[model samples]
Target chain A: MEKFGTLTAIAAAYPKVNVDTDLIIRVERCAGTPREALGPWAFEMVRYRPDGSEDPGFVFNREPWREAKILVAGENFGTGSSREMAVWALARMGLRCVIAPSFGEIFFGNCLQNGLLAIRLPADEVRRLMALASAPASATFTVDLARQTINGTTRFEISPRPKRMLLEGLDELGLTLAMEPEIAAFQAMDRPRRPWIYL
Target chain B: MGRSLFEKLWDLHVIAELGDGMQLLHVDRHILNELSGSRAQLDNAKRSLKPRHPQLTLGVADHVVPTEPGRAGDKTPWAKNVMQIFRDESRRDGILLLDVNDPDQGIEHVIGPESGFTLPGTLLVCGDSHTCTNGALGALAWGIGSSEVCHVLATQTIVQPKPRSMRARFEGALPPGVTAKDLMLALIGKYGTTGALGHAVEYAGAAIRELEIEGRMTLCNLSIEFGAKIGMVAPDEKTYAYLKGRRHAPQGALWDQALAHWRTLPSDPDARFDREVALDCSGLVPQVTWGTSPEDVIGVDGRIPDLKPEALAYMGLSPGQPLAGTRIDRVFIGSCTNSRLSDLRAAAAIARGRRVAAHVEAWVVPGSMRVKREAEAEGLHEVFRAAGFQWREPGCSMCVGANGDLVGPGERCVSTSNRNFVGRQGPGARTHLASPATAAACAVAGEITDARTL
Candidate 1:
C-alpha cells in the first residue's frame, strides 16, 4: 500500500450521482484483468464509444483531466458491489483522492484499505470543489492527510485508525497479527463457549 | 440502556480494540467464491502467509461457473481455469472446497445458511456483498473487499469501525401476493439507496417474525442495496427449526447449548437503536424497477417518477409510464437473493398452468444444488418446463452474468437478483428488479405484469 500524505495535483470533476462500481470498472473487465493493469479499463463504459474511440466528452478523456489525480464527484459515488477492483482501478488510474458528498459504505472502506483518500463533505462543499475542478486552471487541488484538509481550507473527518493507517502505510493484517496473544486468548475463551465453531 | 443485537454480536467477536472506534473482530465463518477468493488466496500465498484458521473457511465455485446441464465437464476456458485455480488454492490452504460438481455447491450466501455453516451469534464474512443474506440466521455477516479478504485469511479477524445500529420495524401482516421481496423493494424505494449507510440494520416486528427463514433471507439479502453492509433478523423458533439437523449444525448436547445461546441473540425489549424506521407491509404491493438503480422502483401498478432523465434514457422508459405492461424480452428467476426452494416454488406456482410468452425467454436457476434437487423432487421443474420456462442447474446465472448467462443488449429483463445497476446483467441490458413470482408472471405475459393479476 502507498502511504497517503499531502498531494497537490490536477483534479477531474464528474458530478453524476450514484456512479456505481460497475460503471467504474465493468464486470467483464474484472474477469480477466490483473489488479494493477486495470488502469486503462477504469470507467471503460463511458470512457469509450462503439467505434473503440475515446469519448471526448468524458471528463477523463479530455485535456489536462486525462492526467487527473483527484476526482470531485456527486453523492453516493461508487455505490454498488463489494468489488475492490473498483478502488484498484481508480488508484491505478492515478487518482489519489475522491471528494464526494457521500459514498458506498464498502467502497469507502476499500478506499481506506488501499490508501486512496475518500473524503465526504457537505453537498455544497462538494459542489464548490466540483466547480473549481471543472476548469483546467483551477483544477489543481491539494489534499493533506496529516492536516485532514483539502485545498488547505475545507476540512474532512476520518476515523483515527484509518487516518493513521493512511499516514503510515500500515499493513492492517500485520497490525492485527502483532496482537497474536490477544487473538489466541479470545479463541481459547470462545472455544469452550461455542465448541461447535472450532471446527 | 439495554444493548442491541448488533452490540452483543460485536462484543462477542471483539478480539481486541485498536483505538479510534476500530475493533479487531474474530471471524467465526469465512466463505469464499471463485471470483473474489481466488485472488485473495493467491495474493496471500504470494506474500508467504498461510490461512490462520483454514478450517473455519469454505470455498465454493459459483460466481463464474456454468449452470448449464453437464457443465461439470463443459465450461468456458476462463471459467474452467478459474475453477481449477480455486480448487488448487483451497487445497493448498487446507480449506474445504465445494467445487463445481459438489452436490452442496451453490452461491456462498445461499449454501452457507442451508448447510448450517451460518448460525446465530456468529460472525461471517464473504467477498461478495450478498453475504448479508446469511445474516437472516441472526449471524453478523457482511461483505469484504479483496484486501480485507487477504487480511481475514492471515489473521482470522477483520478490523472494523463499529457501525451505528438501525432497526426497521415492519408492523402488520403482509397482504397476500406481497412477499418479503416486495417489502424490501418498498423500503429501498421509499428511502434512497443510502438510507442505512454506516448503520447495522435489524429487521423486527410482526411481519419479520411471521416471515419464514427463506423470506427473511430474501429481506436481508438486499440490505446492501439500501447501503447497509450488515442486515439481520433476530433468531426465533423459525430460525432454529430451519437450522436443526442441517449438515453442519450442532447435534445432541451441543444443540441444546447452541439453542440457549441463540435464544439470547435477539435485542432486549428496552434496547435502543441510533435510528428507527417503521413500515406497514399491509399496503406493500409487488415492486419493479423502472430505472437503473435498485431504488428507482415503484409498485407494479405505480407510474414511473419523472426524475432521472439519464436512467430513463438508458432504460428506454418514459416518465409517468406505468411499470406494469412494459414489454420484457427475458425473465431471470434466480440469484443469491431469491433462488431458494421457496423462491423457485413461488415462481413455479405462477408458471404451472401458463406457458411463457413466445417472445420472452424465461430461465429458473436454483440457488443451490440442494434447492434444485428439492424443487425437482417437488416437480417444480417439470411445471416450469411444461410452461416453456427453461429449468437450469444451480448457480448465480444471469444475475452477474459472469457465467455467460446474460440478458441480451438492449433487451429488457425482469430479474429476481438483488442489483439493478447499469450493465449489471450485461452491457446495454436494461434490468427491472422483481421477485421470482413477479418475474415469472412477466415471462408468461411477455411484459412486466403483476403476479396478483395473473
Candidate 2:
C-alpha cells in the first residue's frame, strides 16, 4: 500500500504564518459552491477582494506560483480553527505536497485524510529551500523524495515512515486493513486462556 | 537505542507492526463529542463495524449543545439527532456518556483534562483539534477526523506515521497583564503560522515552569496553530497534584510509583532536537490578531498593519489603523483557550461595573458548568452581568460558531477564542483574537484597549 510521488512542480514563497481555517475556505463556499471553487478561494483572507483581481505584488500570485503544484510555506503553515475546508481548498488548488517547518493539528489531520503529503523539513533546511525557491530563476530547487534528497546541490534525506506514506499514498485506514488477518486472529484467541472479561 | 516519547508510546500500543512506519496502536482513550458522533455513526453504518472498546471511550454532548442546557434540542435539528444517537449508542454499549445535563459535560477537550480523564504518560485522542490541549499533562495526544473516529471506535487502535520533534524553550516571567494566551499568541507571531510543522514541540523554561497547570493547558491547546501534533510540558508536581483525587488517577502506593516515573519524563539538558525555538515572555503585551491569522498579531499598544490590496478588501479593516482605537462591535470571553477561572478573573478585573460601550455586545461563557459554578460562587458572574455582558452556560458556544450565537455579518469582534480566521465567529463576521482582559476592555471601551487602562 505504500506509494510515493515526486514533486511535479514547485510553488514557493513564504506568507505570514499561522493561516487559519475560515480564511482558507469561506463557509459560504463550503455550503454549495463547487469543490473546485476552493482554488479561487484558496487564501481568502489573503486573496479576498470585493472585485477579484490579481495583486501583482502578492507573494503567491507573483512571479512563478501562478500554477504551483506543490506549496512550500513558512512555519506553523496551517494553524487556527478546525475547518476541514482549509484542506479542501489547498487540495483543490493542486497543492499535493506541503513541505514546511510545521502545520496545524486539524489541518494536518485533514490533509492526511485527503491523501495530501505534508512533509516536515528542518526549519533551517526549509529556509534554504524557501530562499532558493524565491529567486527568479537560479533559486529553483527540486524535491526528489524518491531519491530522499530535496535539493540538487544540497540534498536532504527524509526519515523512513513519512517517505513510505508519501510514496504509497496509504492512509491509516489502508494501513490498518492491511492487518485484518492478524487482528482477527488476536480476536479469535480462546476466552478461557485469556479470560479478562466477557466478549 | 533511545526512543522518544513517541517511540515509547508507539511501542507500548503496538498490536501488530505492519512494515514501513505503520502499526495498529491500542487507543487508551477514545474521546467523542457531538460533531464526531454523527459522522462516526454514518461511517459505521457504511462499514458495518460494531463497537470495539466502548468502555475505553467516553461521549459528551458539546459541539452542538446550546449554551442554555434546556434548549439543547433547539440548538440544531442536525445536532438533536446526533446527540440522541450518541446517548443511545453509549447506553446500548454501557459506555460512559456525559450528555448536556451531566456535570462533566462541556467542551470535550477542556473537561477531559480538568475532570480527571486525561493523565500523565498516556495516549488521549479526540475528534477536536484542541484535543492536543491534554498533552499539557505530559501525555502523547492529538486530534483525529470523524472517519478516524469511526475506525478507532470499531478498533481501539489508530494507525499513524511518526513525526519529527521540535523543542520550544520559553524563558522569563510574564508581566502582570499577560497570560498563557498572550504567550501563545506571541509565539505564533514570532514563528509565523507554519513555524512548527510536523514536529512534536516540547515546551520548557522559566515562564513555562511559572505557569499553573490550567495555564499550561492553554499554552498547549493552540499547538495546532503552529502545525504541531501536540505540545508537552514535562510532568511536574503541578501536573501530579492536579491529577490527584481525580476519578481516573491512580491511588496510594500506585501514585508514588507513577510520580517517581513521571518526574523523569522531562528532557535531559543534552537532549537534541531537529529544531529549537525560544521566546522571552516579559516583553509581550496583551496580544490580539488584527488579520485572519493567529500570528497576524500586534501588541495592545500597537496598530493593525497595512495590508496588501486584497487583504484590505477581504477584511474590512483599513491599513495602518491603530488597533487600540478600532471599535469592536462584539466582545466574547470564553472557549477552551480562555474560559478558565483565571481568564474570567482577568476579564472581570477589567469589567466590574464598568458599563460596556454603547456599541458593543459582550458575552462571558464559562468553559464548563463546573467553571460557571465556580465563577458564580466567586461572584465573577456578577462582575460580568453588571457590565451588560451576557452570562452563558458552559459549552463550546461561539468558539466554533456552531450554534446560532454569532456576530452579525460584517460586524467586528474581539474574541477570547483561539482563532480569528474569517467566519471563525460567524458567517461574514470579522474577528480579532485577544486575551480575556483585552476582550473585556474592548467591550467597555468599544475599541481595543489595554486591560491595565486607568
Candidate 3:
C-alpha cells in the first residue's frame, strides 16, 4: 500500500469521449468467477466484439496508449453503467492515472476504489494534451497527483480536490477501518448511552 | 468552470469545512434499500448510533425481497438477511419503513416520486446511483457511499466540494417509437457516459416538456450513466399538475408557497453553462446494447462496431459483426429503470394473444406491487402469462443478480433495465439493452428484431 498526493508519471492520452466501463474492462475476459473477474474481465464488455475478435479502431487499442501510464481523454470519459469492472480493468491494464475532461459518476467512484486516478481537466486543456501526445511518437507528459496538475513539455496545471485516499490506496471501507482508534474511543466513551449499537 | 448537478447541490448544502477537503453539507432526505443493509445500516448499528435527521430519512425494502404478496422475504438467505435488517432498523430509528408486504413497497426510486417524497426544487440523497430519479421532480439528487450514508445518519449531512454546471437541451417531439429510456440511451451513446461528470444537468426543451412525470423521472434516473449525479427538469404547469393531490404533495397555503419557489428553480433563460449539448428528438430509434455495455449499442436495424485489436484484446470480441439477427434466448421486460405501467402495457401490447417464440424464455417483473396490481387490473399480467412469459412478483429481479433469476451462461437476452455491463444478468450471459416493447418483440421472434415490424 502506498500513498502520494503528488507523483509524476508518463502520460497516455485517450481522446474519445464517453468511453464506458465495458471498454475499460471486458466482462468476457473477466468471467469465470468473482475473483477471476476482478483481474481480467474488468473491461471485457466494451473491449471485445461478438465473434470474440478485437476492434482495432479503438483508441486504447492503438499503439500510443497500449502501455502508457496516464490516459488523457476527451469529455465524458468513463460514462454509462455503474459496473466497477471498468475501473478494475483499467487499473489492471497497468493504468496508474486517467486525466479526462470529465467522468461518469459510477466509473469515477470505481476508479477511486480500484486505485485509478481519474482527473477532470478542462476541455481546452484536454485537447492540448491530446495534441501533444499525437505530435511525436516518443512525446510524453507528466502528471502530478498531489497538486492535481498535468504538465509536460506542454505546461498546463489544473487544481481539483487533493483527496488523499486514492494516493494512499485507501477505499471507503479502508478509510472507515483506518479510523479504528477514533471509533473505538467514541464507542468506549458512551456505551451506556446507546446499548443497542454495541455489545 | 461548469458545475454539474452535484456541484449545485454541494454548493447550496455545504455548511462548513472540516479538516482537509472534507466538508459537511445538509442532507435533505436519506433513502435506503435491502441491498445495502449489511455494509451500511448494519455497520452503522454497531456504533449504537441514531440518525441525526430521522424526519429526513426513509427506508424501504425492495432489492433482495420476494415481491409475492404474502412473501415477507426472498427465498434466499442473503436476501432474507437484508430484508429483516431493513425492517428492524427502520422500526428502531422510527423512520418510515415500506416493507415488502406493505402496499407502499416498491423500487425506492420509483416509489419516491410517486409518493411525492421527492418533489421539485429539493435536495435528495440515496445509496443508489439511480437515485437521480428525484431529478425528474425538479430535485437535485445523487448516490452516496455507505460511509457517506453513515455520516448523513449521524450528522444530517455529508462532505462536499462543488461541481461544474452543464445543460443538455433536448428539443422537438420524440417521434413515435422513442421513449425517455430510448432518448437517455441515445444520449449516453453520444455523450459517452462521463459527459455530465461533476456538473449539474438541466434537461430542457420541447421534448422534455412533453414527457410525463414518470417518463421524465426515467430520463433523470440515467443521469449517472453520463457521469452526472444530478439531473433535473424545472417544475412547470406539468410539474404542478402532477403534484396536485399526491400523498405528500404540498396542500393548502403550503401549495402556493411551494409553487412560488419551484417557479424559480430552473437555470436562468440565458444562464451560461460550463458545457452544453443539444439533442434532436426527430431521428432517434429504439436503443439496444449489442455487446456487454450500455454504450456498446446499436439501433434496432444497426450493426455492431467494427472493433479494433485493443478492443478485441480488452473484451475478447471480434470486429465486422452484425448485431442484427443475433439469437436471443431470454427477454426481461422489467426493472426499476423501466418497469412502470407504461412498460407493462408496451410489452403486453405485443404479447397479447401472441405466443412467445419456441426458444425465447421471458419474464415480466413489475417494479412494485402497485404496478403489478395495476397491470393485473388492466389484464397485462394475463396477456403475459398467456403468451408464455413468466409473470413474477415485483422486485428488481434479473436486473441485478441478487435474486435467483440469473440469465444462463452463454445465453443472450434483451433486458429493459438500465446497465448492460457484462455478467450483470448472469455469468457469461450477453444482455442487449432495449425498451419493453422491443424486448417483447424479441421474445416473440426469439432473436434480435424490431417492435415496429412485429
Candidate 4:
C-alpha cells in the first residue's frame, strides 16, 4: 500500500447516487484480471461505448477532468458488493481521494486498506465540492491527510486507526500479529467456554 | 440498561480494545469461496505467510463454477483453472474444501448454516457481502473485503470499529403469499438503501418470529442490499430445530451446552437500540423492484414512482407504469438470497402444472447440492422440468453472471437475487428483483405477475 499524506490534483465530479461496485468495475472484469490491470476497466460500462471508444460524455473523459486524481461523488457511493477490486480499480485509475456524503460500509473499509482516501462530508459540502470540481478552472483540490482537511479549508473526520494507517501505509495484518500474546490469551480463556467453535 | 444482541456478540469476540473505538475481533468462522478466496490465498502465499487457524475456515467452490449439469466438462478452461487454484490452495492451507463435486458444496452463505458451520452466538466473516444470510441463525455475520480475507487468514482476527445498533420490528403477521423476500424488499423500498448504514440491524417482532429458519435466512440475506453489513434474527425453537442434526452442528453434550448459550444470545428485554423502525406487515403485499437500485421497488400491484430518471431510462420503464404486467424475457430463481429448499418449494408450487411461457427462458438453480438433492428426492425437479423450466445444478448461476449464465443485453429479467444495480446481471441487462415464487409467476406469465394471482 502507498502512504497517503497530502495530494493536490484535478478532481472530477460524478454526482450519481448509489454508484455501486458493479459500476466501479463490473464482475466480468474481475474474472481473470490482475489487480493492477483493472484500471482501464474502471467504470467501463458507462465510460466507454460498444466499439471500445471513450464515452466523451463522461466527466472523466472530458478536458482537465480526464487527468483527475480525486472524485466528488453523490450519496451512497460504492454501495454494493464487498469486492475490494472496486477500490483497487479506483486507485489503479489514479484516483487518490473520494469525497462523498456517504459510502457503503465495506467499500469505505476497502478504500482504507488500499490507501485511497475516502472522506465523508455533509451532503451540502459534497454538493459544493461537486460544483467546484465541475468547472475545469476550479477543479484542482488539495487533500491533506496529516491535517485531515480538504483544500486547507473543509475539515474531514476519520477514525484514528484508519487515519494512521493511511498516513503511514501500515500493514494491518502485521499490526494485529504484533498483538499475538493478547489474541492467544483471549483464545485460551474462550476455548473452554465455547468449545464448539474450535474445529 | 440491558445489552442489545450486537453488543453481546461484539463483547464475546473482542480480543483486545485497540483504542479509538476499534477492537481486534477474533473470527469464529471464516467462510471462503473461489472468486475471493483464491486471490487471498495467493496473496498469502506470495507473502510466505500461513493461515493462523485453518481449522476455523471453511472453503466452498461456488462462484465462477459452472451450474450446468456435467459442469466438470462444461466449465471454461479459465473457470476450471480458478476452481483448481481454489482446490489446491485450500488443501495447501489445511482448510476444509467443499469442492465442486462435494455433496455439500454451495454458496458459502447457504452452506454455512445448512452444514451447521454457522451457529448462534458465533461471529462469522466471509469474502462476500451476502454472508449476512447466516445471521439468521442468530450469529453476528457480515461481509469482508479480500484484504480483510487475507487479514483473517493470516491472523484469525479482524480489526473493526464498533457499529451502532438498529432494530426493524415487523409488528404484524405477514399475509399469505407475502414471503420474507417481500418483507425485506418492502423495507428497502420504504427506507432507501442507506437507511441502516453504519448499524447492525436486528429483525424482531411478530413477522420475524413467525418466519421459519429458511424464511429468516432470506430476510437476513438482503441486509446488505439495505446498507446494513449485519442482520440477524434471535435464535428460537425454530432455529434450534433447524440446526439440531446438521453435519457441522454441535452434537451430544456439546449440543446441550450450545443450546444453553444460544438461549441467552437474544437481546435482553428493555434493550435500547441506537435506532428503531417498525413496519406493519399485515397489509404488505409481494414486492418487485422496478428500477436499478433495490430501493426502486413497489408493491406488486403498485405503480412505479417517478424517481431516478437514469434508473427509469436504464430499465426502459416509464413513470406511473404498473410494475406488474411488464413483459420479462427471463426468470432466474436462485442466488445466496433465495435458493434454499423452502424457496425452491415455493417456486415449485407455482410451477406445478404450468408451463413456462414460450417467450421466457427460466431456470431453477438450487442453493446447494444438498438442496438440489433434497428437491429432486421430493420430485420438485420433475415439476419444474415438466413445466418447461430448466432444472439446473447448484451454483450462483445467473445471480452474478460470471459463470456464463447471464441475461442478454437489453433483456428484462425477474430474479430472486439481491441486487438490481446497473449491469449487475450483465451489461444493459435490466433486472427486477423478487421472490422465487414471484419469479416463477413471471416465467409462466412471460411478464411480471404477482405469485398470489396464480
Weakest 10 consecutive residues of candidate 3 chain A by summed lDDT: A190-199
What clash pairs does model 1 have?
none
Docking class of 2: incorrect
Native-vs-model 3 lDDT? 0.69
lDDT by residue for model 3 over A1-199, one digit each (tens)? 2454554544666665556554554323322223224544444444456576766765455665565667777666676544444555566666777777676665666565555777776788777777777644533666666555556233333323335666666544434444445444544553343221121
Order of candidate numbers by lDDT, starting with the best: 4, 1, 2, 3
Off by over 4 Å in 3: A1-103, A106-199, B1-14, B17-23, B67-75, B308-322
Residues B1-454, candidate 2, lDDT per residue (tens digit)? Answer: 3445544444545677656765666667778876655556555756666676676687877776778535443535555666777777667656788777777777777788877777776677887778888888988888876657877887767776666788788888889988888899999888966677667888888999889988888889888776676788887888888889876666776667667766666666666678889999868788988777777787988866775454455467777777788777999898888898888888899888799998888998888778888888999989888889989877887777776677887988899888776677776777888888889989999887888763
C-alpha lDDT of all candidate models, in order: 0.91, 0.73, 0.69, 0.92
Question: Which candidate comes out best when scored by lDDT?
Answer: 4
lDDT of 2 at A117: 70
True contacts reproduced, candidate 1: 0.71
Where is the poorest 10-residue window by lDDT in model 4 chain A?
A26-35
Error of 2 at A48 (Å): 11
lDDT of 1 by residue, B1-454 (tens): 8888999999999988889898899999999988889888889999899999998998988888888876753446767676777889899899999987799999888999999999999999999888999989999999999999999999899989999999999998999999999999999988889899999999999999999999999999999998899999999999999999999889999999999998888999999999999889887889998888899989999998999999999999999878888998999999999999999989989998899999999998898999989998999989999999888887888998887888888999999998888888988899999999999999999999989988
- Ten contiguous residues minimizing lDDT sum, candidate 1 chain B: B69-78
Put down candidate 3 lDDT per residue, B1-454, tens digits, no spaces.
Answer: 4333434445555555545555545556677766543345665788776775576777887666664435543557646555666778878887788887788778888788777777775667876678887888888788764555666676565555455777788987897878898888888788765567677788988999899877887788778876777788877788888778876666776767667766766666556777889888898888887655466666778866775343333334456655557788899988778888888898898888899999888988888778888999998888999999988877777877566667887778889988776567775677788888889989998888888888
Give candidate 4 misplaced runs (Cα > 4 Å): B72-75
For every model in order, the TM-score on chain A comes to 0.97, 0.76, 0.69, 0.98
